[model samples]
Target chain A: MTLFIQQLFDGLALGGVYCLAAIGLTLIFGVLRIPNLAHGTLYMLGAYVTYFFLVTVGVPYVAAIGLAAVVLAVIGVLLERIVFHPLRNAPHTHHMIAAVGAMFFFQAVAQAIWGADFRRMESPISGSVTILGAQISWQRIVIVVTAVIVLGLLTWFIKRSIHGQTIEAIEQDRTGSSLVGISPSRVSMLTFGLAAALATVAAGLVAPINLLAPTMGDALSLKVFAIIILGGLGSLPGAIVGGFTLALAEVMTSTYVSAAAGEGIAFVVIVLVLAIRPTGLFARAVQR
Target chain B: MLTVRGLSAGYDAVDVLHAVDITARAGELTVVLGANGSGKTTMFRTISGIVRPSAGSIDFDGRQLPDLSADSIVKAGLAHCPEGRHLFAKMPVEKNLMLGGYVRRRNRGRVRELLEHVYELFPILHDKRHQPAGTLSGGQQQMAAIGRSLMSDPSLLILDEPSMGLAPLVTAQVLDAVAQINRDGIGVLLAEQNAQTALRIGHHGFVLAEGRVVLSGTASELLDHPDVREAYLGV
Candidate 1:
């Protein structure tokens, strides 16, 4: 029983990172209407940024995460303005192609700067707390707590803030929003910046627990795609719930079934969900 | 006041509006009557800065509107209640209305007043404020769309087919609300396929056919014009 509880606890901590990453990707997809293939690249860069701040500049762990978020936000805005904005009117395929191009370009950049070698950052958080005979690492606990706070703030902002409401408006109707004085371009920029910040923060939180490499984000990007698809594309709550669900599934499969099956679970989920309910688990016909 | 001179605009290569000339005086309801694909929507979109004119200029309350962005145009006091009542269907009706007041959001008290004004104008919307806009009856949705545009406190409100999908009684109710709105001293530019009903309440009217203005006059004169009656009124 304790062993099962330990596995469940581990899944919850890992799920926080997935949830944050999925929310960012979902937000960009919902508002900007871009699939954003390069989303995972932003996560990879975020881990490196966190590493630079923590090891080179010697900033505190939390401060490193904050600085990484700011840096990623700027990069995100630049990416939107320079790459996506020009092709806003092009066909959907054009956007996807551009995103894939961006992903490759960023991966090359990361390889050039950080090299292809894998590096692991030391966690400032050490020690473990025991609960019900299960040991939980302090780093994982910090990650879980940070995810909760950030998710809470994000939900509140989207639900309550005027700016967030504008984002929602744009997501619902682009031309309608513009007629009412919401600049779609401005909102797109803000969404990209926010998405980037979310991705980076998620990456930074997990950096202490995982090895970092230029290729690290490739698998992560695919997993996020699966998550968003499972949750329902452009559905915010879908993405949130989908993220945790995917993480827990993987954790359970790895523990009870085979490790290889756990690694392949995302692809299976994508196929099964698409074949059965392509609109996803949350999407429904518009009310009325 | 709004003025459009030699305005030409369209999608891609196909021009939907051709050198359309129009002038809507401040505080008066100006109606543009047209059949489907007659370019009423394109004209309004050009004025609202959604579709850029291929030629000519637009002047709104003395501001050069051609070069301004869509949001800037709204800030300049022209709110477009687009055809089809494109409210954020999933959001509550009040949220949809509040978004119209987004530019004036900094002035909390003023926004509140605008909200109150819209509620007063469409009490049904106030009662259904918490409901998702898509769930409203067709007439109520139209009311919500008009109320949303009014929230911007636009000096001139451009309404495109508020009666598009409503029942005859509901259409009359919505149009009555529009007339009441115009009496409140805001300028109105309305486009409608229901020509006679629109001209009855309008100060000035223009008839559009195949992307060109075929006729223009005071509402009473247009009502009596043989060409208008023969073509649009089906008399």
Candidate 2:
């Protein structure tokens, strides 16, 4: 029973990373109305930016996360202004192509700057604490707790903040939103920038727990995409539910079934869910 | 006040409005009457800057309007209540009304006052304020859309087909709100296919057909015109 409890906690913490990453990817997907194949590249960039700060500038770990978020947001805004904005009206395929090009461009830049080799950064969080009979790292606990706080803040913003409400309004009816005096282009820029910055927060929390490389995004983006699709595309709470569901499936499969089956669980579940409920688990007629 | 002369606009290679000349003065209601597929909507869209004019000019409040974006036009005190009651379906009614006052976020007290004003204008909206906009009845939704447009405190409010898809009783209630809004000193440019009801409350009216204004006159003159009576009034 204690072992099961430990595994469940581990899965929940891991789910926090998935939830943040899915929100980042899906926010851009929802507002900018772009598939944004380059999202994972932004995620990888976040980890590297923090690495740069830690190794070169030597800021404290928490400060590195802040700097990375700001830097990534700038990069995202520049990318949208220079590349995405021009193609916005051309065709949907054109935007998709630009995103692919962006992915390769960012990936090449990362490889040139940081090299193709994988590197590890030691977690400043030291030691572990026991819950029930199992032990968990402080870093893991901090990642989950901080993610909850960030998610709470985001929920409040979308529900209460004027800017966030404006964004939600634009997402629902672009023409009406503009008719009422909100610039769609401005909202687009801000959404993409914030979404990219959010990718950094996910990376800052989770990248240290795993191996990092330029190719790392290629693998992880697929999983995060699955997480969003599972939760129902463009639904914020859906992302939350989908993240934990995917993580729990993986953890449970690994514990009771097999490790190989654990890795493959997300795909299997996605196929199953899509076959039965095409819109997804949480996607209804109206999604907030 | 708003003026359009020699205006032309449309989707690429398919012009929906042509050389349309119209003017709307302050504190008066100008109704543009047209049947379905007529260019009334395209005309409104072009004037609001949703569709860029291919030629000629639109003057609003002493400035050329073709170059301004829709949001910029709204900020310049022209609010468009688009067709289809396009409220954010998932958002609360109060939020929808608040979003109507979005451009005035810097003036919180004024926004609150605008909210109260809209509630007074449509009390049902205040009662359903916390409900999602999509769930409202057709007439209620129309009221919300008009109330939303008023939230921005626009000097000119452009309402496109507030009568669409509503029962006759509901249509009267919604148009009553429009008449009241006009009486409150805002310039109202209304596009409607219901000539009888629209002309009855309008100070002036224009008839549009196949992308051009076919006729224009004072409301009583339009009501008396044989052509308008034959084509639109179904009298």
Most accurate candidate by DockQ: 1
Residue A170 lDDT (model 1): 82
Q: Give the clashing residue pairs of candidate 1, or none.
A: none
lDDT of each: 0.91, 0.87
- True lDDT of residue B176, candidate 2: 90
In model 1, what is the error at residue A142, expressed in angstroms?
1.2
Model 1, position B145: C-alpha lDDT score = 93
| TM-scores computed on chain B for all candidates | 0.98, 0.98
Candidate 1 TM-score, C-alpha based: 0.97
Interface RMSD (Å), every candidate? 0.6, 0.9
Give the range where candidate 1 chain A is weakest over 10 consecutive residues by summed lDDT: A279-288
State the lDDT of candidate 2 residue by residue for B49-162, as single tens digits.
Answer: 888889889999898988887888888899889999778888889999999999898999999999999999999998999999999999999999999999999999999999
Off by over 4 Å in 1: A284-288
* Residue range A1-288, candidate 1, lDDT tens digits: 888888887788878999899888988888877799999999999999999999999999999999999999999999999999999989989999999999999999999998999998998999999989989899989988999999999999988999988888887888889999999999899999999999999999999989999999998999999999999887888988888989989988999999999989989999999999988898733221
Over B1-235, each residue of candidate 1 has an lDDT whose tens digit, in order, gives: 9988898999996899999999999999999998899999999988998888899889888888988999988888899999987899999999999998988999999999999999999999989999999999999999999999999989999999999988999989999999999999999999987789999999999888999999999999999999999888899
